[model samples]
Target: MVSTRVDELNSERHRFALGIFMAVVVAHWAEHLAQAVQIYVLGIPRPAAGGVLGSVLPWLVHSEALHYGYALVMLIGLVALRPGFVGRARTWWTAALVIQVWHHFEHLLLLGQVVAGANLAGRPVPTSVLQLAVPRVELHLFYNAVVFAPMVVAMILHRKPSADERALTRCQCARPVLV
Candidate 1:
């Protein structure tokens, strides 16, 4: 039963699954954007500007486990839904996966540092490798933006595919073009 359901998800139901996943991704982006607005526009202190959800649950927003879990979820979703795309869409989706792999690694590193009670380079807060070059908030925002860019491209190509690409895909994600 489990195997059949998994197959159905990656095949016939892939479009619906991808749509739901993308909605979550967009909501996450909205949170980051809202945080940016809070910091830049409203002049909220950086520590206080925890985004929408952060405003409500500040502790959860600061948790490394939550960040790592989201990264893992993004990685899993990209891998799981990959079979729904083909040709250029697949290529773009793969690009996003590659970037997310790195993003996931960075989050893992942060989580590890937190668990070990040691920050990288002897910093007070848990810091990612890239965080050495960029501040945490900016670095994460950049990472999310980069991963989202190729994802957007993949989704666009997936839905408006060429004849060959359309034929290759199992999902009904493609839209019909008027003659």
Candidate 2:
């Protein structure tokens, strides 16, 4: 009976983790769908379209398959690292919203004003780098810090003293992988 109860608990944990992972995946794909509709159905230009129409969207869309592949790998890896956004649902969701808002503002502020031509992978890409200044970069960095503050707080709050001390020590030495 004890073994069965333990198994059931583990199953519940796994299901919760899977649900969180699925939410992230679904949000990203929904963003992609919005981008497609904006680009094709509305007949909007690439740069302008993404910023105005798809700016609030979450997916990291790439123009080519290679870009998409790389993004997918990174996304999966990041998702796997946490497995779930465990603990403090309100805090995590608030963090996510802040991050999303900051990201959209980044697009609008950075990419909106194009004054010079930029190059990418031997291709002459036109961008607004000249319009972006040091102040904008600083502001964006500050926004990023603020957005991540909740996660940091959560970790500090949830960490046990023994485990925390051990983690600190392990950082100075070689860390062990549970798997």
Candidate 3:
């Protein structure tokens, strides 16, 4: 039953799965955008700008567990639905997955520091390697943008694949030429 369900997800439910995954990704992006607006447009102090949800629950923004959980979810979504894509779409999807892998590790690094009560390079807060060069907020925005770009490309290609790709795919995501 489990194997059959997995196959069904990749074949029949792939479109729905992709939609849900992209929705979650977009929501995360919106949160980052909101945070940026809070900092830059609203003139909120960097220490206090926690985006929309963060406004109500400030701890959510600061929680390493929340950030790491999101990274893990992104990675899992990419890996779980990969088999539904083919050819160029698959290649782009793989690219997103690879980048998300690194993103997940960065979050893991932050979570690890919090868990051990030790910050990188003696900083007060948990810091990722890239965070050494870039602040955490901007660094995460950059990471999400990179991952989301390839995901967009893959979705576009998956929906309107080349004829060759259409022949190779197992999912019902490809759209027919309307001309």
- The residue-by-residue lDDT of candidate 2 on 87-156, one tens digit each, is 4533553564456454454444333322223332233432223224433223334443554455345334
* Full-model lDDT for every candidate: 0.91, 0.40, 0.93
**Which whole-number lDDT from 0 to 100 does residue 129 have in model 1?**
96
TM-scores, all candidates, are 0.95, 0.32, 0.97
Clashing residue pairs in candidate 2 are: 114-128
In candidate 1, which residue pairs clash?
A: none
**Candidate 1 local lDDT, 124-157, one digit each (tens):** 8899999999987788889889999999999999
Instruction: Name the TM-score of candidate 3.
Output: 0.97
Error of 1 at 44 (Å): 0.8
**Candidate 1 worst ten-residue window by lDDT:** 2-11
Q: Write the per-residue lDDT of candidate 3 for residues 14-111, one digit (tens) a residue.
A: 99988998999999999999999999899999889999999999999999999999999999999889989999999999999999999999999999
Tell me which of candidates 1 and 3 scores higher on TM-score: 3
C-alpha RMSD of each candidate structure in angstroms: 1.3, 14.8, 1.1
Model 3 / residue 84 / CA error / Å: 0.5
Candidate 3 accuracy as lDDT: 0.93
lDDT, candidate 3, residue 55? 97
